[model samples]
Target: MANSDMCNSVGASPGAIQAPPLPAFQPRSCFACRRRKVRCDRQSPCMSCTRNITDCVFPAPGRATRHGSTSAQTPKRKQAHLLSRLQRLESVVEILAAQVKGPAESGTLELDGAGLVGQGIGKEGRGSALDDKTARLGEELGLLVIDENGSVYIGNQFWAAFRDEINQIKQVFDNDDRQGDIYSAETSSLNGSIPSDLTRQRREDSLLFLFWQSRGQDVPLKDLHAFPSQLPIIWQIYIENVDHYSKMLHVPTFAKRIQDLQGDFSRMTPGMEALMFAITMSAINSMSNEDVKIKLHAEKSDLVARYRTGTEIALTLADFINTTELDVIQAFSIFLDTVQTMESPKYVWSVAGLLARVAVSAGLHRDGSNFPGMSPFNIEMRRRLWWNILFIDGRSGSDQIAEASLHEEMFDTKLPTNVNDTDLDPSMKVPPITRNAITDTTPILVRSEL
Candidate 1:
């Protein structure tokens, strides 16, 4: 009896027979709540899951925590990094929300295509939404400064965008064994040493070649011109990639004139000079830096900057604001096409406005049919130029700026005919019949219809 009573007392007080303690009760999140990254009540069907009408699924029970579990011993560095990342994500969301809400409140948001004007847009919505946002963000961040002379200082903010891009490129090359050597070679090339692969194809008469010859000196008038052997390639790229949709030039006629010029710029007018520079710049702008290095042995940035400068100088020489030259207007409009994507919207809009005013004074807003002595060819070309001016003005304007450069009722010039470029000639005495079928101007025509 004594032995039995002792055994029962020991069993009742037993530490040796006790079960191990489980982890603190972890409230199970339903699959929907977990997916949404929200807290969940440990119900069969969580509120979120029920509200969302999702399948209420619970994860299987996990093993209870053991000593020295990783969950309890996570490094402070990792936790800090995670918290920092979350904070950055929240900041980005806040900035984006502000951008969206600001535009909405002002009713000045401009979409990509300005073809749809006036469903309910207000008078204040005359400028580009992008321009408004750009101005707002730039001022707030101290990123952009516009001068009285219209020069924009955005170098600091411009490069800020490339921070992540450089890292991305570095990440791609990080795994390579030759990263140091690759970087060294790139550094050498950037330090004015020509790449070995590019040296063979480099020509003495190339535009970049000319730029190199005058690197630290004032370039002479003659040096601004080029007789590069790769003219055919640039022409090909322009006609296919650029002119296909723009329909700015009468390709067949312009090609013939260029062929006749035979790289001679001694007799070229200032307006013509600007147009040529714009053409080359636009072509180079369309190509990749690597591609340009391979073909022309020049830095793409250098080429573009030089030609853009040249275009500005030539326009100044032509007195674009006062002088009435068709070529000058054409050159300015084409340069706008190249820069509208890169330059400030305000600057582009300002220039586009000037172009429209000049165009109006030059009688481009009127149909050539209203003029009695205009040749058939001149009339057609004039129509093309007028429509192009209108389109460029529309493209550069904001959705909610003041009175835009273009208004539909302000011009009487008709849409360009859908006739092929080959059919129209500088010497054509009779007006060519318009075509019902698709032609060279079909792309422009389709856009015009819109």
Candidate 2:
């Protein structure tokens, strides 16, 4: 009777709903399991990947997978995300194609294959900013290129620069829209108002943090941050040997300018700071075992760390992105030459692009002789900077999408006269351009038809 009563009680209760049974035939195996030649639990990662601590990726739906079988196994959201990426790629290609075929007479673009275009501006627009912001964005994104005639275009190679790095960065940062909103707000506020005392403090703190992160800990922060009286010796070493390796800098001018600055790190510009550290590091690299490597208990490695730290700090402190100074270009040029790595080809490619854009923004790409108020010394400096950029581009290898931004054809700027900084005064009349072999000059002028 009890059994009968219990059976009746159980039957009276509602039956629990069960998930529908999975199909007896498996749709597809997980990638790892298939590769291992084993069966899968048909779970997202399956047991094998979970056991091995590996990522489990499945083929997208509506495609034939590794086993030669089409599976509608991908989630709806994933399919949508992939579709969005495809759309973006298509849109990018289309926009580039339009820009490439755009009317040439509509705007003036400096054709070093960097797409530095200016619209609605007259002849002066070529050097002055008309579309600098757009040009910078394209440069930063590695999307655009200009030809020898200042013709702009976009090509397949645009996406190739740092492609792996971009993917990895994307993985770490999924919500770009949110980040963009925050950035816009920050930028607007920064541009609209003078920074408060608190804001200044925050900035200082951030810079300090950056310095600390940049190898400041290898030695006393003060040692790394401040320029010492003895710093000139290291710079002297670098300047003397610089000509043997590079023609990007005018050694006499650079040395004299360093002397003029008089070891005041505080007064030094971002470009100067970058150049200082670059030279210091180069000097350290060039040192022999017999030479003294220790100063204030700081070894060569410590000094190197200091210079590297100082370079980054100075770059940020001087607002390198918005400001384009000749000093900064020289710094980047030297830094590029000093640092060697397996990843240099890709890294230097982007850097070369940046230096090119900076040169264009400064109007160094154009002939300055036409400008009425420009000094002879200033014109000579601009010419020197432009040619130096061309040399750097040659060494670093320009982006695959475009040739180096500063081309020989567009540059009508006269070559710098082969004269020492001390001999040529700013007040003196600028010398006429002459061939190097006829003048018996250094390899810098003699090697090329400048």
Candidate 3:
């Protein structure tokens, strides 16, 4: 009985003293709150945990050991680092938006043959669009249109057609078979040869011949004299040619024979005056030495004294040479004689040939060469050939001339020779021979074989 009482007193008796049960673990808020050293409310379905805020996770029951504490803190530290990274990302997005909304807007982007927004399109449409844009740009810049075709023709289409018609006229003039005759025999035979009294009739016949030769297009004879303002640009060129030629023929020539020409000289008109001045200037220029400054000055002084004309008279004569008048060559020859009292040896044949054509046009001769004194023409042709040689000599250097001379000799001898034999050394310069030296030293009538 004493042992039983002692066991009860020491809680050895059954159910005398039982140890208290451990308290159940209640999870706190998330790991983020704990790492931040903030107070966490021990709640079920915690606000941070339910919101997927893993940073606020609480420790598990019986995990309050030293190892458990370190493991819990690691997760909390990672969650806190991740939150800081997310906040930095938000700040970057806001800064980018602010920069984009600033004052400097994007500049205009330029594209090449393909326009802006060059996306899906057919090949043909793309090509056409590019061409249209190019053309528009060219027009804006005032640039010439150089397409696969040729130059742009913005004027009347009639002028373009008329140009084709005039080209045919040039072809007729260039014909070799109709060498001497201005008018074909077939046409001349249709119209009888009228006397000088029928001047009006002759003019009409000439106008018809000109029209027929030029593409046989129908136009009024009256319209030939006064071309219509509405006529095409090409026809304008023809009309101008006709007017100039008509005026040219009416100009009287200086007396071929002194006694028979006095009456003609007395009846001189404006046309005659212009013609005479042109002829005199051509003659003077043909015979003039390269350095004929003294002669030109003297002629100017004489013109001022006798004709009381300005320097413009000489300039006008030069302008006339470029004209398409039928009598230009002959008129120029006559003028040449008047300038230098000496006969022209340079252009006599060309003048004769041109005159023969004029005479044939008048139904006087079908062959111009049949006219008397073809000797002067022959002489002039030879002189022109030599003149060309001298001109070439003046322009080329010594080495070029030496090579040319050697080539000529080799050809003449019909032998093979090296270029070295020609002595084409550029170091040796050759002074040009003066035009006066060529004219004075060379005999105009010299004839050599080969």
Candidate 4:
């Protein structure tokens, strides 16, 4: 009676009670779950196993507890626990999918040749999605593509890719060779080296040809005479070149041309005299030595003598004006127009002073009665006259003054008589004695006031 009472209290039927049989294990869930740490349902593609997305497999039937009694309850307990774990996993996967696919998908998706559905690419066929994307990117950025076979090809943007690939290939080849001799030879061949002197000569020849073509028959000669004032600028270029290249080559032709130009200035019109003077100054500045200077000065003296003789024989301003040609007048006008606007006021003043001396000698302002309404004391008229004389004398220079004096003496059939030594600075010194000098000198015809 006592035994029966104890069995009843423990809820056993006289003997120990056997546990109920556990469900069969499945291969679709993990062994840890199958051992009843969690349940592995015998579902083919089990819900707990599939939802967790792990490599699901079962442990052997006898692999649980030592008595084998716990094995019967293992599957049931693991299935229940796995069901709860799977529910949590499914929720986590849903949260991840939502996070990945958010507002970005609301906009239009760009599709390339790759089989990518979203930002995460999916591979299809023989080529991977990554491979296809790489190829597309290489093409866009003008990169070269190297195949699995070790062959190279211009991916896209053909020219740029081709150039880069070629350069890289060359660099590799160059490294293998180690000696840069081949590269140097190729570069030399491509560039075709030339001597610096030859290059300079070629350039100068080209410029000379151009100038010759533009100037036609006139070239050096006509240009020299046509624009007497610009002679200085022209001479400057020649002089600079001569100085630079003197050791390399003699410029005898250049020197001869310069000499001829100096001679030509004497015959220029009175209007262009200032331009000639400027040219003379340029020649003086360009002379290499004292001998050249003296020669130049002597030539100037001869030119002045001829010009003076010619003008003095004319006897009247009309005669002088009539003797002048249109070309001479035009040339003179062109020169004056250029120099009048020059930045150097000294040049202007020098030209003006020279002109004043010439006009006074020419009898253009005798008793101040020649020009209508002009006064000896009229500053404006005097200034205008001064400018006119300056323009002429500056272009002609002292040579022209000497020439006029010589002409006057020759026409009168006498030598210059008034041989006074003028003060070097008119305001600073008295005129020198002339009586003794006049005895041996030729007589210069002095015109009376009109």
Which has the greatest TM-score? Answer: 1
Which residue pairs show backbone clashes in model 2?
111-150, 112-405, 113-146, 114-146, 271-327, 271-328
Give per-residue CA lDDT, model 1, range 87-138, as digits (tens): 6546544543343333333233232221211111222423544345434322
Looking at model 1, the pairs that clash are 125-399, 125-400, 126-400, 126-401, 127-398, 127-399, 127-400, 127-401, 128-398
Error of 3 at 197 (Å): 28
Candidate 3 regions with alpha-carbon error over 4 angstroms: 1-258, 263-275, 278-322, 325-450
Candidate 3 versus the native: TM-score? 0.18
- Candidate 1 vs candidate 4, lDDT winner: 1
Off by over 4 Å in 4: 1-222, 225-270, 277-362, 369-371, 375-450
For residues 1-450, write the lDDT of model 2, one tens digit per residue. Answer: 999999887767788445455443233455676577444555666777788998866543332432332453234533454445556556655654444333343333334442333231124334655355434432332222222222122222344422432342353234232211111112322333465767654564464552334533444323565356667777667756664444555566667787787767667655677667767766665665346355334566556656766666655555454455666666666665665332357666666777677666565655554333346766666676677667766656744545544455444445666755444446657544443443212445554453
Index of the highest-lDDT prediction = 1
Which of 3 and 4 is the better model by lDDT? 4
Model 1 TM-score, 2 decimals: 0.51
Candidate 2 global CA lDDT score: 0.52
Against the reference, the lDDT scores of all candidates come to 0.60, 0.52, 0.30, 0.33
Residue 417 alpha-carbon offset, candidate 1, angstroms: 0.5
Which of the predicted structures, 2 or 4, would earn the higher TM-score when compared with the native? 2
* Candidate 3 residue lDDT tens string, 133-214: 3343222221111122111111122223334334333433343232121111222222333554485444534433311122
TM-score per prediction, in order, is: 0.51, 0.49, 0.18, 0.15
